[model samples]
Target: MEHINQVIEQLNLEASLTLEEIPQIDLYMDQVIQLFENKFTESKRNEDDKVLTKTMINNYAKGKLIFPIQNKKYSKEHLILMSLIYQLKGALSINDIKATLTGMNQKIIKEEIDLDSFYTSYLNLTRQNVEDFKVDLEDSVKDVNEEITGDKKGDSPYLKQVLMISSLVHMSNLYRRVAEKLVDEITVEKEEKRHK
Candidate 1:
């Protein structure tokens, strides 16, 4: 129960970097990797787990997930795109991510919105989503405890932990499925526009 509280606390503290926090100057691969590694240290599951690597960056470029670099240095826009990719890759396939980005880019252009403006709006939405998620998570834990309390098996601390983990995993799965559906819709929309 104590550990669960800690997990909730950590999630509440999770935040994406603001645009001002990013360097204005272009960054070489090593510097970019180091920046993400340092900033996302808390996100690592293990001591040796890397938040970002040169290989990943190269792959992203090769896959066209990001724009081409200039003179072997990545610009601020590249950093923002990479940050978005990093977040999306947790639940989306590479192809899905590519399509999603394409659709978003098209929409942004149509709306005459710059990347910085779009990202700022996205950050605000994310903050609100996180707050909503926190409330939902608290409710979920409370519900699980109530159900467990009525069952004889609830006496086992391990059972409580298992139930908690199961609930979280199911919630994550639900979100993932919804995201995939939205990506599919984006792909369809792009195809329709192209054919028109």
Candidate 2:
């Protein structure tokens, strides 16, 4: 129970930078890398894991996952996009991310929306989702405990941990599947329109 509480607490502390936390000035590539590294160090899975890298940034530019840099400096918009890409990479394919971001850039180019407006909306939803997730996790723990109450092994910490991990993985897989389907639909719609 203590371990479970600690996990929940850590989840609540998951790092995400607000718009105000990002540097307002354009940053050189090295500066951009350093900023992400410093901000997301705690989010890394291992001590050796890098939060961002120059090669990764360059590849994002080449793949059109991000807007082009100007005078070798990344603007705030670029940083926001990169941050989004970093977060989405675990749950989305690179091609899907490219398609989504490209569509967004087209909208901004056409004056349909501004970057800050979109990012603000995203941030709002992210914060709300995290809170919702924490509640859901607590509820899941209770449910799992009840389900295993009659079994001889029910009191085993290992059993609780296993069940919780299984439940969480199942839920995440469902969400990922739904997101992938939506991305596929978006890609197909774009292709069909281009052919018309």
Give the alpha carbon lDDT tens digit for every residue of 1-196 in model 2.
4377677665434677679988999999999899889888877767899989989999998998886788999988889889899889989999989987898767755768778888989888988888898788889999788776768667787888888899999999999999999999998999999999
TM-score of each: 0.91, 0.93
Worst 10 residues of 2 by lDDT: 5-14
lDDT by residue (tens digit), candidate 1, 1-196: 5466678666434657679978999999999998887777787667888889888999898988886688999888889888899889989999999988865544544656588998998889888887898788788878877878889756567887788889889989999999999999988887898899
Error at 179, model 2, angstroms: 0.6
TM-score of 2: 0.93
Assess each prediction's global lDDT (C-alpha) against the native: 0.82, 0.85
Q: How many clashes in candidate 1?
A: 0
Q: What's model 1's overall lDDT?
A: 0.82
Which candidate has the highest TM-score of all? 2
Residue-level error in angstroms, candidate 2, position 171: 0.3
